[model samples]
Target: MVRLIAFDLEGTLVKSVSGWVELHKKFGTWEKGKEYAEAFFSGEIDYATWARLDASLWKGHTKDEILEWVNSVEYMDGAQELIEFLKKNGFKIAILSSGLMCLAKRVSEELGVDYVYANELIFDKAGRITGEVNPVVDFQGKGAILRKLKDELKPELSVAVGDGYNDISMFKEADVAIAINPHEGVEGDHNVESLYEVKEIIEELTRGQ
Candidate 1:
């Protein structure tokens, strides 16, 4: 009896491996961004500091410019079909990601998702990036958020689908954890090759419920 489904944005719903990395490449800041990422992974800087450092790299860019880059990101194959199937079956859809909010909001709106949670880049009064961010989702904070949502939504069962290590926390919180084309070493209750397979898995899970 799955009543809610949570998805990871980058690599899960979208074809991009990382919206942050893509933006860094687009803005010509990948080298620096890579350093920050390494620092975060090596236990040097914290997630907030890493995010701030990454956001600072895009300081002075217009919001429209960033939006344009976001729009360029393509959806994963069968993303639309899978989402439509979930909606048609009356499941609440949520996107919980540590990625940028611009892409999350875009995907949520286009797919008609019920809930979205992601980090947001702050901007100045002139609509330019201000090197600041509101870190709503941390790399390992997805479980806590999902726990809160479970209390609030009171769903009979909740499912989570993702493709990265950051999604493992989310997997722990879900009644059903699905890893779709997951990164190496990432595991879940089920492993799927694509979103089409994800739809099939869900269908079988809910077949008699």
Candidate 2:
């Protein structure tokens, strides 16, 4: 009955582990950059504030440089294979992420997923980072968008895969949730280390159905 499968774009789909951290490194925000994640997870800040903070880090960087950074990202091994497998198995695919839309859009288009919900970064006409962003999903709000997708796609069941604190909300809404190579204490119905294992998990879960 799992008809719709969703994937998180950062750690789960992109192999670099953290797209945000990559941004921080690229923008010279790593000095105090890691602190923002702690603030975000501790409820000290929301995604909007977090987005603004991120933008502040890249304010002087050019759009071309940012786009180059985004394009240089490497995807998770087996991501393309797993996506193709899901499609072949009759599941409509989705991407629910709090990550930047630039990379998510690229992955979704490459995989041809049915839907995607993610945030966007804004830039001024001069092509510089504006320190402003439009958020599509806040922390703990990923499920809200999934709920919206459910209403639109009308799937019988939903499956999700992720590997971060932000992804915890997705686990609650999915009929089947897999935490992929998670951080030390994150939880899910099942846990895995790779997208290859995810395919196996799904097959076993839906066997004989």
Candidate 3:
């Protein structure tokens, strides 16, 4: 019955706690960005404003520098293997993240995901960061997107997996929600210590009824 599996990026696909924080650290604004991140989470500022604030901190950075940071991201244990198994099993693999489009695109291609949804981090014609961002939606907006997908594709069974507070909304939208290396106290139908364990869950979910 399972036909779709959506994943979060920062902690789920990559080991980094926050892709935005990673970029901020690489570009020398991690500390300042933290305040904005807090505001974003508290609903004091919208995602577009938060994204632009992050971009503002990296104003002078170049595309190459950002890519260098993204390229250095380490994949979660068994992330590639899990992705392969999902594709092979005919699951519509989707990556839904509040992370930047640059990194999301790379992750989508690397994982061979069927759908990717992420916010755009803009760049100038000269390949320099533009200090602007095209916002998709808030972290909670992941649920909205997933709901839209369900309405359109109507997957017989849907699964959403993530590791942090932001994923709770999307998880609620899924028939089966999984938490991978979840933050303390986060709850889900399944709590897994590693991505490799997802294989077992998929097997159980997909086994013939």
Whose TM-score is greatest here? 1
Ten contiguous residues with the weakest lDDT in model 1: 1-10
Q: Candidate 1: which stretches are off by over 4 Å? A: none
Best by lDDT: 1
Per-residue CA lDDT of candidate 2, range 1-209, in tens? Answer: 44888888888988766566788888779866778778877989977897778777778788788778778988888988988888878798888888788888888898898888888888889988788888887777888877777788887768889988778887888888899988878888999888999999988866776
lDDT of each: 0.92, 0.82, 0.86
**Candidate 1 residue-wise lDDT, 1-209, digit = tens:** 33889999998999878888988998999999999999999999999999999999999998999899888889999999999999888799999999999999999999999999999999899999999999999999898888888888888879999988989999999999999988999999999988998999989988877
lDDT of 3 by residue, 1-209 (tens): 44888898888988877778778777678889999989987989987888898888888689999888778888988988888888777789888888887888998998788889988878899998889988884768899988988887888989999998879999999999999989987878999988888789988898883
Q: Is candidate 1 or candidate 2 better by lDDT?
A: 1
Per-prediction TM-score to the true structure, in the order listed: 0.97, 0.91, 0.94
TM-score of 2: 0.91
State model 1's lDDT.
Answer: 0.92
User: In terms of TM-score, which candidate is stronger, 1 or 3?
Assistant: 1
TM-score, predicted candidate 3 vs. hidden true structure:
0.94
Report clashes for each candidate as comma-separated counts.
0, 1, 0
